[model samples]
Target: MQSTSNYLWLLKDILGQGATASVYKARRKQTGDHNAVKVFNHVSYLRPYEVQMREFDMLRKLNHKNIVKLLAVEEVGSTKQKVLVMEYCAGGSLLNVLEESENAFGLSESEFLIVLQSVVGGMNQLRENGVVHRDIKPGNIMRVVGEDGQSVYKLTDFGAARELEDDEQFMSLYGTEEYLHPDMYERAVLRKPQNKKYGVTVDLWSIGVTFYQTATGSLPFIPYGGPRKNKEMMHKITTEKPEGTIAGVQHRDCGPVEWSKELPITCRLSEGLKFLLVPILANILEADQAKCWGFDQFFAETNDILHRSVIHIFSLQQATVHKVYVHSYNTINVLMDAIFRQTGVPAVEQEFMYEGYYLELDLAQQVHLVPKTTEERPIILVSKEQKAPIGITYKEPDVPTFPPMFDLISDANLAKIVTCAVHQLLRITKSIMKCQDFILRGVYWMLAILKEECRKTLQRAATLNLKLDFCKSTMMRIQKIYGPHSRMNQSDGGDVHMKLQLTVHFLATISQNVQNSQKQLDQIAAQWSNTNDIHHKDSTIGKVEVLLEKVSAIHQQLKKDRMRMKLQYNDEQIHKFEKLNMGIHAKKVLALVREDCEQKYKKLLTCVKDWMRIACDIRKQLRSFGEQCESLHCDLENCEAYLNNMFHQIPLKLEGDQSTTKSTASTVYPDQKCMEMAIRMKQLKQEMEHVTKELQQNNMIIQSLSDGQKPQGV
Candidate 1:
């Protein structure tokens, strides 16, 4: 045990030990506050005096939340050697966290994000101060619990850190072997003769290795034994770019890289996050420094990710998982609002639970906590209205049943059963074809009717528009002759002019609707035609039938031969013939035929089911189209009625001098035409809304069917 003037350190309370110094947990005498004290051995002082003070100076110069803070410089009472006291991180080192059983595959995504933000912040600060941390690894990063009960990682152990500009070069190698740059590794680990100089980008390589390990719990590049035991192979794996190699990971010496462009299966990060993270790792871990990303670009991308919304999985009481995008600083209420927008559920009636504990709105203000969950352990959302035990349930889609396999009792019986199945399938296929033909003819007939209706409606709308235009011209002439004060202009002419404008607008809308409906009908017809032609040929069933016929003929011949042999030989001779394995050979042939027939039957059944589904879908679409046609027909009738009323409301004769000026509007436009057009427009809108709702429902049905086709595990 050792004691200082203001602090006491016990030998057994050591926090960490390195080659030059041993860090021990210390307590301040006055306040009893715990702090970490770094006591250096005599050998550490033997280095250049400038080297001895580098870490202290660097720590003092840098001031950032992610960088550990230096409290005070102290001296050991017994040794009289210099020591440094810093803030104590209760959560210990990141290496310790990685060693835990849960993180054996790697840190969870939430934990990894904390590490990413912390390390990036610390490195950005270092860059601002023109400092490069050559040793950036898990062991040198410490985890501290913040005031909000969240993990905050901080950079520690600045022994290998130094002030170096981006363009400047450093020859002295400093880093862990696995994380060292290839150029530095050659000189440091391999002890090879080289005069290569490294720049600030060397730190990027270390950061890459550190991050790769943190995300996947393993290094990117490795050898047959290890990076240390097989130094030559590790250097080759890191430097050489063979045709099949990826990120310098090979299955064996001189072998191709084992990984594709994806992360290892052991990685715990989601596929979406992995997509964003892999490029960063690839650029930083480049053996050729020229290709590596600059610090500015690196920081920009990482910060962009940090600031963007994070996706989290949430389940509604053990139902399917829903992905919710929320920012890390967003509160639980914000998450609930997002859920409500996606699921149409009120936030107030929902409760969230995480890891078997109720996640309160006040405590879980940061959405970053939600990323720790997964599909299996998603944030369970309980509805206050439903009172049921929480449990996950999966419903598998119903698979179609096929004809059962025939028992191979005798060659004749097996052949007979296969032939029967083939005949049955052929009949079913023929019936399906007949149904398809009937439906196709019906669709074509309906299409012809709709096309004629659409053309007639368009022509009627055009005729009405022309009459409305002539009425407008007449109204203008009336106004010009009446000096804007005549009773015709004030009372009847003004109303007639307004009605003409409304009628024109409605005519244009009706034309547009007809055109749109025509286009939709064409598309539906094309889709149905394509689906109907999908299984136009029954070639698969025909093949099965042909094969069964051959097997049946062979069985008949074999039966004849057996009868002939029985007639030619005695009972004792027949027994000897049975012992010759001829019966076994015939049975084998029947078994083979049975297997082939079963497979063909299954395939045929699947095809039939698919065709039936397509037919049903076509029927539904046709039904919807028919309803739309009826709506259009009603719209046309209303327009005709509105035009007739308009014609009656206006008078054709002008009893004054205006009779001399040929009136264009005449009695074709009426005073009630505007109100009638408005009513018609409102009705058309309601009908369109109904059609849209029906389409939406159909789309939902299609989506459900598609989901049912996917594997249950998915």
Candidate 2:
């Protein structure tokens, strides 16, 4: 891994044409050992010589077992092409390996590790030098056959590697067909080809593609196909996930060839390998570069893996060290643009005003969206999944008086906002009702996630026959605090509503796993549940038994209230309220909004609208109440009659008691405390006055009858 001459020349005799460059089998000539010489074409795009020179400079500096050594760069007068000497691989590229796997690679964990470790490790070395490999894939990664017939992998072809000395978000298009990052695709579409510029982290994406094909023997994304055709395949890699692994098992056709069959999966690799590879590959292939791991992060992860300190991500995060949760959150709305069906924004004839953010729509756009009545439009949530940690916003090269455009959010940072907001709302509210409701939604969603996901996660804490309370008295606090008040325990509406949303989110996520586990169980439920039906000869049944054991352990964990206090703090609902300042106006409208200033009043409304846009819920009773009010306004007599019937048959439920509802439906913050209660009390008094008139009529009839009936009785 020492620096070589500025340029290199390969012997012309060994040169052979390749998809990219002229490749040849050569040697250092000094040592006369076999080495590969790669020469680039420089005329059309980059001076081919410059690209080779860049790679030479990088490879010569990069030193790692997982990476091939760049022994020397051949320099000759008036070079026809650039030649770089590298360790020649006798085993050849992984592409050769895949083409040879007619049935499947049938690779074991040890074998797959030989590839992944080499790929990740080599990339790690490049990153250590601030060099970001812009392309990582099967064609670029070659495997060398060792003396004992073992394959040692080597990463080559750094034509697109970028040296990032400072933090820079990738903003251009670069890489092979299926290996480009999401940002690259978007930028390519958005800008002119000449204008589009990309960054070095694109290498991570290519690496992800390579890993996918290396691990699964199929690209997570389809290669050589355009974006549309490969979307489904790409979508799965970016969003949908399977068991965080694949090994040992053979697959059979379930439905069709296009629809992959139930392939045999091997649970062979140390679970650590899957944990490290799956998430990283997923992020690397993220539909949005901003949402995926950048080179810096990729380097850190590979370094960690090289050291063999990879713990299950789920468990490791649970440890109290509390490193910021930096998972990618993409803008799903952007990816689903093809299907979300564009609703054209209408032009405002008159410039309209909003509290926080203003609107800018056109007449044509409005007409386009008009067919879809605004009343029943499908709500869109700002996907938390489609975004990456903003970290701290990059300080501008030059300071200006203009305001900043982005607000960064992380768990540590969010904790400050949440804790402060909770304390403020708690102090401001007369009855902790509003504050409790706010707190409930956040906690509920967290618990819901726990129920849905945490429960379903396959990670476990067990060893030495130690029954460490995976979840202690702390997680069970919900039952303790509101256990008696839970709906199952005759809980009130407030708790029930929050719990439902929280539970729904978790349940929805968990349901997928439930379906998966159930399907797996159902597939083998016949065999395992009944020993008589068990067949030792059937490997599928045996595999199912092993799956059942793992699933059962997971099921037990899911059933347990095992998620940490985070189930209370870190959920979408809570995040919406505290960090985003959601429903603060509901919790205390009077305090948050100013009645006198219409501008300030409108601002509160805008905030609420934004929150609702995220698809939060409101109480049903509130909806019915509005409908009843409208009916009364339409026909007083009919309304009064109906109310009388309702009064006799069913008492109106308390709004606060009926559900844990955020006032998402309302944008304008109603006056709170004295003003809001005073208005409501006034309306009730007027209703009482009207009822008194009806009672008076009845009073008169009874009195008159009593007077006349008294004489008749005598």
lDDT of candidates 1 onward, in order: 0.64, 0.41
Predicted candidate 1 versus true structure: per-residue lDDT over 115-172, tens digit per residue: 9999999999999999999988898999999899999999999988899998898898
| Count of backbone collisions within predicted model 2 | 38
User: For every candidate structure, what is the RMSD over all alpha carbons to the true structure, in angstroms?
Assistant: 23.2, 31.4
Number of clashing pairs per prediction, in order: 2, 38
Q: Could you tell me the lDDT of residue 368 within candidate 2? A: 27
lDDT of 1 at 214: 91
lDDT of 1 at 61: 90
lDDT of 2 by residue, 537-654 (tens): 2232233233334333332332232332234434434333332332222223323322322232233234323332221122122233334334422333332343344333221332
